[model samples]
Target chain A: MGKYLSFSIIAIKHGYKNKGETIARFAFYGIILLVFSSLWNAVGSEKIGLKPRDMIWYLAMTEWIVLSYPLIHTAIQEDIRTGNVAYLLTRPIPYIWVKFFEGMGTLLLRMLILAFAGFGFAYFITGGLPTNPLGLLLYFPVGIFASMVVTLYQSIIGLFSFWLQDATPIYWIFSKCNFILGGMMLPLDIYPEWLQKIAMLTPFSSFLYLPVKACLELDASLLLEALIKLTVWAVIGLIAMQLIYLRGVKKLNVNGG
Target chain B: MNLKNNYEFFTHLLKINLKSLTSLRGAFLLQATFMIINNLVFFTMWWVFFKKFKSIKGWEITDLCALYGVVAFVFGVSVIFFGGVRSLAKMIDGGDLDVYLTQPKNTLFYASSSQSHASGWGDVVSGIILLWFSGYLTFGSLPLMLTVLFCSFVVFVCIGILFNSLAFWMGPMDSLARQFYDFVVTFSIYPQVIFSQFLKMILFTVIPGGFIGHLPVSLLREFSWSNLGFLVVGSAGFFILSVVVFNRGLKKYESGNRFIGVGTN
Candidate 1:
């Protein structure tokens, strides 16, 4: 626990040092929020069932999840390719746990910065806050769980670098799946029934769609269901990461790393 | 350099890029395939959107398809033909400009044409497919559509060069450059009528998203001599401006005292 806390501090420092990049990213997110606000305001009507404000705020939540996650895949892929994982393995701490805490440190800071930026922009455009501010405050823990699921999934994808010469194309596919199925661009409920059903079945929905949906609507039953699904997905992702790491490390050892 | 010499150099670079990509045949194919599928997944969002709302403002699903098709094609052509534009920030920041500077050819052209992106072929393919699927492809409209697409291609590449050239002055502006590039891309695929009058003005001039996203669709759907003129002039103006900015920025590059290396000797 102490080691993880120390690693988290290091990651926080790293995040702080890259303030320029963070500001640029904030600008990007803000611009995207503005564009979406204009789009939703223009298109949203009585028939669409979503208010412009709600839709924009929902997008804020979703985009936060998409943009704020640590680029764990790149880190893992680089370590594997350059044989840095060999040196990392010699450390007293376990590699995956170290990465987890490091990722948490960066992810928390990014989430807060981007959320504030996005929410501020949404408020400026819509002239109001989320309908359920209390629910939103409550949704923070659920959001953290969702982030863990996404990070663990990324770790699994990154570990594939040991076998694949380049895991980027694979990660691209995974990201696209997360974008479409995860409801980063639109609410899953807005999708066709068949597509919505398919999306809900996937872990992508638990990673992004469920958490955002829970926050926006703030239904007690929905929140509970989303939490349960997120927990299940988190467990599955952790198991997958552990299994992949074990195999990847064994392969690296056999290759004389 | 003369047009003939430029053409020869581009073809030479294309040949080498193709060779390097084909060397890793499986990875190349997989990358292209994934890119195409990725595009299709994005398209699905629009599919669901139109299914729900039917149309946004005056734009319908068919219009959305055309927008995506044109934007993707323009982006693909820029990357496939002038792949080096995407790497401009990294090259400039890393002091890798020394080689291009020393070369006798046009530095910007050399820098942009030095690499090829295999996934761009996927975009080109999917873009054509989308255009055909959208029912906008007709014998009567083909010529005009081609011209507009060409203009869009010019504007896209110019915008990329314009943004990436920031590295020359600011030093190591990869993230900022990429975000601006992404801004152009994200806004270019949406319906332009959604933007307020002020935002529309900015889009037309500063970001130039209006040229590639809105104007082409308008000109294609309803022939407008004024819009067509704007498209042509705007493309030319932006292209010239990009060249000027890149040349000016080149003067600021400090080389960082790094060893200059080109392709394997």
Candidate 2:
């Protein structure tokens, strides 16, 4: 655990070193918020139950989780593809946890940076913040846990490289699932009841919808429920990763040295 | 090379790319099929949106479908045929241009067309299906669709090259190039009616997202020779600009002697 904490600290430092990429990401994040806010405003926020301000804030929260997602899957894929996983397995620490901690480190930095930048952009675009300040405060832990689950899922996809020729397509489908069922763009409240029910059944909602919902309104019961569900999903994800990693390593084939 | 020779070489390059792509038949099929499914899943959000609101700013669900169709089709064509366009920045930064430079052909086209992304086929197929279902594709409009698709494809290629070429002036800025690429694609999928006039101006000019997404969809929605003419002129201008930019940047090229895949397979 101490080593993992060290890994996260090191990753945060590494993220700080990459200032240019971070700046570019923030620029893109701002642009996307601007575009989506314009669309919502054009649609007339009154038509929907929510205000344009809330929607902008919701999008900011969701996009923060998504944009901050470290491509740990790609790293894992490359490691497996280039036969570096064999060398990695020789290390004292578990490779999967190390990658997850590194991702958490990067995700923490991104979430922190984007939290400030996203808030500024959303506030500028919508001219206000979410009405519930406590909910806004709660978003940090919820968002981090949500992103950690996403990291685990990404690792699971990367581990599939043991059997599949490429795991990118799998990642694509997972991301789109996050977009649709996870309610990345619009809140699931507006979705049809049937779709919302289906979304709840999947772990996708725990990724974005639940976290952003915390910011929409302050409800202690709802936040507690969301945390429980997210915790459940995280446990499931970790179990799945362990199973996949164990099976995958058994079938590993190295091409060069 | 003359026009005819260039055409023949490009066709040959595409054939070789396709052959290599198909060599891994299972992976190719899986990637393409997954992408088609992935795109459809993405559309579900819009589908839900339209289900509730019906339409926004005179843009119906069908119009959005057509918009996505055109954008997907053009994107697929560009990436599948000119896969290297996306990686041009990395190639430039890694000094991977030596292979293209040593080739006895148009270096730009050769560099851009050396690889194929299998997922593009999924996009192409899904795009065609979306257009058909959206009622935007009919025998009378096939010619217009093809023309607009060609123009959109040209703009997409030009954007990739122009941004990737920035590596010449600034060293190894692939992430920045990728951001621009994503910005255009992100801006292109939304209805143009949603943008403010200021943003619209930026869309049509600085980022040129409008060329790849809006103008083409507008022409398809309501046919007009003037709009078509404008698209043609715009695409041509961009094409010329991309060529000039790439050539100017080539002068600053330094070889890192990196080991890059040269399409030998």
Candidate 3:
């Protein structure tokens, strides 16, 4: 509908107006990563074998991935906490679609500001970026698609609020577990072998670590397979998400706050 | 000037914070979860590095765990007692100082002690587990009695106070300041074994990152009476400095004098 399209545009405009926040968030990430990069580089430099540049490049990719964190977590949590979620049900637009799109709009701004800036700034700092420019360029779209996979996951988590008094405890346990399994703080390779193998099969790493690995690693024999697996996960996640929205709407006190 | 009044005031503050926090169990737990997730992530990094290097700059994974226990224990204690450390910028900017000032207790005491975090208990528990695990894994659990534990807790509170004081003047965007504090934590997460001498200096004295986790690492490596003394003096000094700065800032504060909590009319 025309209203839906216009609403999304307004959200983007409102979100991007805080340009200083975007810059500050990037700088925040930069300060943390720079210190971390230097430490890792020094650790690597007392070399068993790995190069400082490898640490630099790995951190650079992780920086961008972290900046492009999926928005579904914040979006769902905000709606549940503020109880403004009731506002969406009476409107002409679909509640799930509007929230999903609004989250995407904010996420788009993050990608442009943090991810794009990180890639550029990282290159300047380390003297080289991702080895495959074309593959990396292709990563942008795949990254967007992967975030939606996570949006579905978040929606499922948020849906529990409708039935439970408070979902935060549950959310915490799950998110913390996901953090280690998803490579939010460090790469999946860092986990013990059993955990690493387990993390690979799950969709959490698909959301953050895989794409970073795809673009950052110069080896291309596995790139096509990575994209294909991502596409498959995207389809499965979106379907489950739509089902959750439908079921969640049936339980809402749509006319009440 | 009266001991009884001060004791009564502190008790009353503790009761209020306990009542507010116990009712909202989930929210309080969520805060601690974030802290725990942060620490666990760092641990994972050390696990990976130790796997390959075996002994990084003469520091093993257990040494890293020892470092973790100090930072975690200190950070956990601060969140429990000095809850206002995170609330400084918002309280100042939003003019919420009016309520605390009008209340018949010390404003700084009220701010720091009047809050509770249930989730912080998780970090405290995790800190214990990590400490227990780290010691058992490393040196078969030596004699670290009550005195050392008390001094370590003091050191944590001092670091937190020092960092929070920086927010008094940083205005509304104190997240940048908080990140810098986290930056200190991140830098200190790794073993100091591989650090350049210059980096070690920056950690030990400049940013005081070494004082946080690195000192505990050294203590774990070689416990001495001197380290205990350092913690006592360092923590006391940091706390004194924080209180001094806070009182000085109060002379310059401009209150917003309005409620900014959820659904404030």
Kindly indicate the candidate among 1 and 3 with the higher TM-score: 1
Q: Is the docking of candidate 2 incorrect, acceptable, medium or high quality?
A: medium
Superior candidate under DockQ, 2 versus 3: 2
**Best prediction by lDDT:** 2
What are the C-alpha RMSDs, in order, of all predicted structures? 2.0, 2.0, 4.2
- Give DockQ for candidates 1 onward, in order: 0.78, 0.77, 0.32
Q: lDDT tens digits, residues B132-202, model 3?
A: 76763234434453344555565555555556555557556555546556667766666666566787787
Q: Model 2, residue B245: what's the lDDT? A: 99
Q: Could you tell me which residue pairs clash in candidate 2?
A: none
Candidates ranked, most accurate by lDDT first:
2, 1, 3
Q: On DockQ, who's better, 1 or 3?
A: 1
Clashing pairs in 1: none
Q: On residues A194-254, what C-alpha lDDT tens digit does candidate 1 reach at each position?
A: 9889999999988888888777887878888888998888888888888888888898888
Q: In model 3 chain B, where is the ten-residue run with the lowest total lDDT?
A: B137-146
Candidate 3 lDDT by residue in tens digits, A47-80: 5343555555556555565555444555665776
Question: Model 2, range A108-224, lDDT digits (tens) per residue?
Answer: 999889888888898898887777756677788788888888888888898888888489999999999899999999789889999899999999998899868865687777778
Ranking by DockQ: 1, 2, 3
User: Could you tell me which 10 consecutive residues in candidate 2 chain A have the lowest summed lDDT?
Assistant: A248-257
